[model samples]
Target: MKIAQICPRYFPDIGGVETHVKEISERLVKAGHDVEVITTDPTGKLNRRETINGVKVIRFRSFAPGNAYYFAPQIYFYLKMHSFDVIHAHSYHALPALFAALGKSERRLVFTPHYHRSGHTAFRNLLHKPYRLFGKVIFSRADSVICVSEYEKRLVEADFRVAGKTVKIPNGINLAEFKHLRALQKDEGIEGKTGKEKTLLYVGRLEEYKGVQYIIQSMPELQEFRLKVVGKGPYEAELRSMAKSLGVEGRVEWLKDLSRRELLKCYAGADIFLMLSSHEAYGITVAEALAAGTPCVVAKGSALEEFVDGTRCLGVDEPIKKEEIIKLINKLKDMKQNSRFTTESLTIFDWDYITEEIENIYNN
Candidate 1:
């Protein structure tokens, strides 16, 4: 079967949706299905056509103001001309999926809405009131609507009143990539912290909604731990200033351009993982931290609250005080030290299983 994965962006861009489509598309290719990714390039710097790991990728030039909305009308024309057995569109936040839904092609339109409900910013949030009308086309036309988390499913159901088929399929993590890091196997418990400083990690886009700023606000009190931030975005400057104003600049390491191996190591080595974002359809980084047996402190109102099972994870609300975060960090350290951690439970989300489930969906 020939499958088309439509998304906002693809490989080298490095975000949740980008990585999701890449993982599934490549695996579908390896499974002997011809898979192609139709995405947009706002900067017009990437190639228009290329093949990575046997999965074909076609990028169209788009107009993305403030790196939001990713308007690409060319995608509609392309899908209207071409045909595929299955056309899976992703990211409800971007416009390409809706464009794919609007195509006249009779292909099975499968949509994976990594939906965060509202927009990422104040301006974008205001646009959502009108955008909700356009979103109806994608939800109503889809043969099957796939949501990445229960939180997303609720939002999609409530806002769109979708009458068609819907299913919850969470994002998967590559546990094998973290196997050698020994985040689970190592016996280095409380003893490991005896002579060294704990590394607090924040690995995602530097957005204000991501709550990285809140972490910076609390940095002045977390003197025994240094921060390693592993992504770049518009909010980096603000976070840097916050760190400097609080005199924690030297302790906060801003990291970007890390290879997959380096990132896995960071997940495995960190004492605690922080993702205090205001919203998340599914926390892929939180899952990765869990796969690495790292303790996580995520925000409560979003899908991330699902990770808090009183084991290796904890939750806190927004508008938290610096003292609260410091307390949470100390609690997570003790929680991890007292319990036995393992990656065995992470097997349910293996890419092979998830790809097979999607294959079954297409086959049916």
Candidate 2:
């Protein structure tokens, strides 16, 4: 089977959707299916066309100046000219995905909307209205609509009124990799932090909507733990200022652009993983944390709440109070110390299982 994955961005641009496309596309290629990715060169630096890990990637010039929502007209033309067994579009908020939906293709159109009803800021929220109007038409075009979480599926059904042919297929992790790391992992504490101070890890783009500010705000009350922030984004400067203003700058360490191995080690070593996003389609890092046998505390109303079974994971509502976060952290730490912490079974998130499900969608 020949498959075309249409997304706004691809490799080297790290995010949940990018990682999802890369993992499934590579696995599909390994399974003897021909796979190609069509995305935009947001940075204008990546090769226009290249084959990586047996999967072909084609990036077109795009007009994505600041915000990640790219505008690529060529993708529509490319879709009209090419033929494939499946045309899988990702991220309803991105224009390239919308264009892929609009393009005339006889192939079965499988769409993973990655939908979030609103955005982080008022401006982005305003922009969502137009995107939603566009997405209604895109949803109509999909032969099968793939949602990453139950929350996303509900939003798609409620907002777009998508009835049948909508499937809930959550994002997956490389279970083998995490298992290997767990096997060989040593108790190497955080790279620089001394003593056995509890380690709190936040790994993802440091965007404002990600709710990193809430964590930083709570640091004044959480002086016992060291916060290690991984990943870079536009919101770094503001977060830094907030940390300094709160006089907790010394407790927070900002690490950016870590390699995959280093990141897994961080997940393995951290005492607790924090994903306090205001809006998340699915918290892939939370799954990664669980796979590493690390406990997680996610935002209450986000899609992550569905995955947290309250054993190794906990959820707190948005605008989370400092005292509440501190209490949860303390509870998780006690649970860890008592050896009573057990992560949710993450076999559902294994890439092998996830890819098989995606293959079935394409075949059907």
Candidate of highest TM-score: 2
- Candidate 1 lDDT score at position 298: 87
Top model by lDDT, which number?
A: 2
Query: Which pairs clash in the backbone of model 2?
Result: none
lDDT of 1 at 216: 86
TM-score of 1: 0.94
Model 1 Cα lDDT, one tens digit per residue, 1-364: 9888999989989888988898898899989999999999998899999999999999999888887888999999998888788889998888998899998367898989888888899999999889988888898888888888788888888888873577888888876776666644354332223338888999999888899988888888887898989999999998999899889999999999899877876787788899999879988999998877788888899899888876578788767666778888988777656765433465228777788888888887
Q: Cα miss at 18, model 1 (Å)?
A: 0.5
Error of 2 at 201 (Å): 0.3
TM-score for each of the candidates: 0.94, 0.95
Error of 2 at 176 (Å): 0.8
* CA lDDT of each prediction against the hidden true structure: 0.84, 0.85
Candidate 1 segments exceeding 4 Å error: 183-195, 337-348
